[model samples]
Target: MKILGFRGNVDPASYTLSDALPNFGRASGDRSHAHSGSTAKGRDGADVPIAPLVTIAIPTFNRAELVEKCVRSAMAQTYPKLEILVSDNASTDGTVEMLRAIDDDRLRILTSEENIGAIGNFNKCIDEARGDYFVLAADDNYYRPDFVSKCVRLIEDEPGLPIVIAAYDVLVVDEFSKDDRRTVPARLSKKLSTGIWQGTDILQEYLHGRISAQLLSSLVRTDILRRNGGYSPHPCASDEATWIPLLMEGRAGFVDEPCATYMVLRESLTEGFTADKRLGDLREVLDELSAVTAKKVSDPAMRERIQQLLNRYLAYMAAVNLVIYRRGGASLSQAVQKLWGWRTVLAKCSVTDFLSTWRLRSIVRILSPQPLARWMAKNGFDQWV
Candidate 1:
């Protein structure tokens, strides 16, 4: 893995995990910048350390209007110590000017003359973060004031906890500009325990290809992430691909309360089933994950569960790619090619015909292009995806 700065480029693979962590970890303080630690007042200049310092990383690309509110939400956290890092991935919008207007001493900006792409930006933020804990804040999402505090508590107290997933409500905003908001409880399943994301215990829940699997809705231990080499610099579902395996750090934990709001936007990745152009990068990352699991984890049952998870995810990717192609943005041939790629990979990893039948209809619809997909949705198969 290579760690590229806004301008400086450094290769991470050259350094051992021990060396990688402390150098970046020095950035993990309650202080936002090297100078002005004392006068860099938060909201009321009050001081509190109940929560560990969390590096709030917002990776933005032209979404200046919504990004500001997202940054402000991070600033409003009741958790006192926060190091806000805004990574502008070559945004042409007035994001730079907007960031400058904030003028909060606690805020720092990292700019790039070239667009290193989304995953690269995400990796850079993780490599550069200066907090005991880290959050992948969306440019359009709003977090509750207690989000950081609650996450820190879980990470600090839980002995083996690696990542802490938070419960959040999903909001569907009006189609106009970025401001009009319509809120509803994000229909997260009770069966899908937050524990699945916590890394505390193995979740029998299907691991592979579950789109709901995410890192943005969770806060992670920086040390653990660094040890694992941070987020995979991949396309599309790298967050899911990397996070599912990392959850093995401990049983997943949850506050059992909604404290954050995930904004659903048309431009957001979740909005469509389109495969990322960097899907190949994600495939490499998953391949690495399976290799790591075989080496690090010893239990057969756990390994089996992980394999099942990967298999399911691969199938889902194929189905989603079909939808994207149907939507007329990408070519059908490319989607089919990726589907075949996933099938070949998972076949080697042990996805049996029996277990693969779990979502057979959905997979078949992608391959055959039947109207049965609509029928499945009517029959509650949409949730199966």
Candidate 2:
């Protein structure tokens, strides 16, 4: 239970829960670089309160060491009013003991009697959260100390904004070698500038791969998240299902600074996914998004725009699946079957739509045989194609 970025070594046994929350007074190293106060300037240059309670819900299973780091990061935040909710999904790996060792009043621990799936654990976290703002923090990922403070500031600056997303760094951890780690700039970090963006614009950016669907990167309004029904039950891509609808409902603010770390573990869920499974899960996600859009959006033109964006996204996903299948050494027939399965769902898509949605490279990939595509990929020509 070693905490990172605390001023000094703290013995958990010496403190009671009441005094565990740190006093983050005006410290020079704080990223916000400003003291908490009642008044701040809105995006429109009007005055607004800067104080709000933020709850970070961390749903974890079977990753004790990583979960401790995640909890330590949350406990080290500079924000004065914050709570860290750690929902354990019946982990047998001593995760509960590790959590109990920490003496923090701001932390609320909830453990399920049996192993609920990841989505169920997430929903439990959401149901238990009691803060003005909510964020879903993954067990393997951690945040910067100023992450909460900075996001709160942005939301306060824009009174009506439902969400605030910040730039983040990617931390790649090797599975075999625990010591091996690398940090890289997350995708679209360069493209994201500090400002308030329209909800539709944010959705468009997300569809274009200019933004990530990680809930850890965004602080959302609690009521809005509850209203949207938290995360979806899809086997995969549920985060997209939860986030897209919320983004469509209200505007979001962006912060340029990298305020969190998204950890990519070799044995993590994303890395273990197979091409077929990924595509199948994505199909579910797409269907859910379409239904949500049609029911929420009344304007026919706007609905059409969203549909077009989703269609393009589906095409892009198909291209990714082709690459994965080829790289994984699947047979030509197997790859074609997977491609055809996806194609059948998108049967109404025209050549013009496909070409426009993914550009010529996707068309080339989709049309080429598996062996040829693999050769092209091996020779590095597939990158440009």
In Å, residue 5's CA in model 2 sits off its true spot by 31
lDDT of 2 by residue, 1-385 (tens): 1111100001100110000112112111111212245765544354534676788889888889999999999999998888788988799999999999999999888888976666667777777777767888778678899998888777766764678877566564562356656555554534557777776776776676565435667888776787776666655455566666766665677776677876655334123356566656667777778888888777788788888878777666666556445445566577678877776666645666557655455445556775675465334464464
What candidate 1 gets wrong by more than 4 Å, as runs, is 1-51, 168-211, 255-258, 267-283, 329-385
lDDT of each: 0.55, 0.64
Clashing pairs in 2: none
TM-score of 2: 0.75
**Each candidate: RMSD to true structure?**
9.7, 11.0
Quote the lDDT for 81 in model 2.
87
TM-score of each model, in listed order: 0.68, 0.75
lDDT of 1 by residue, 86-183 (tens): 98978898998999999787788888897776666776787778775678776766789997777766644543355666656656454234575544
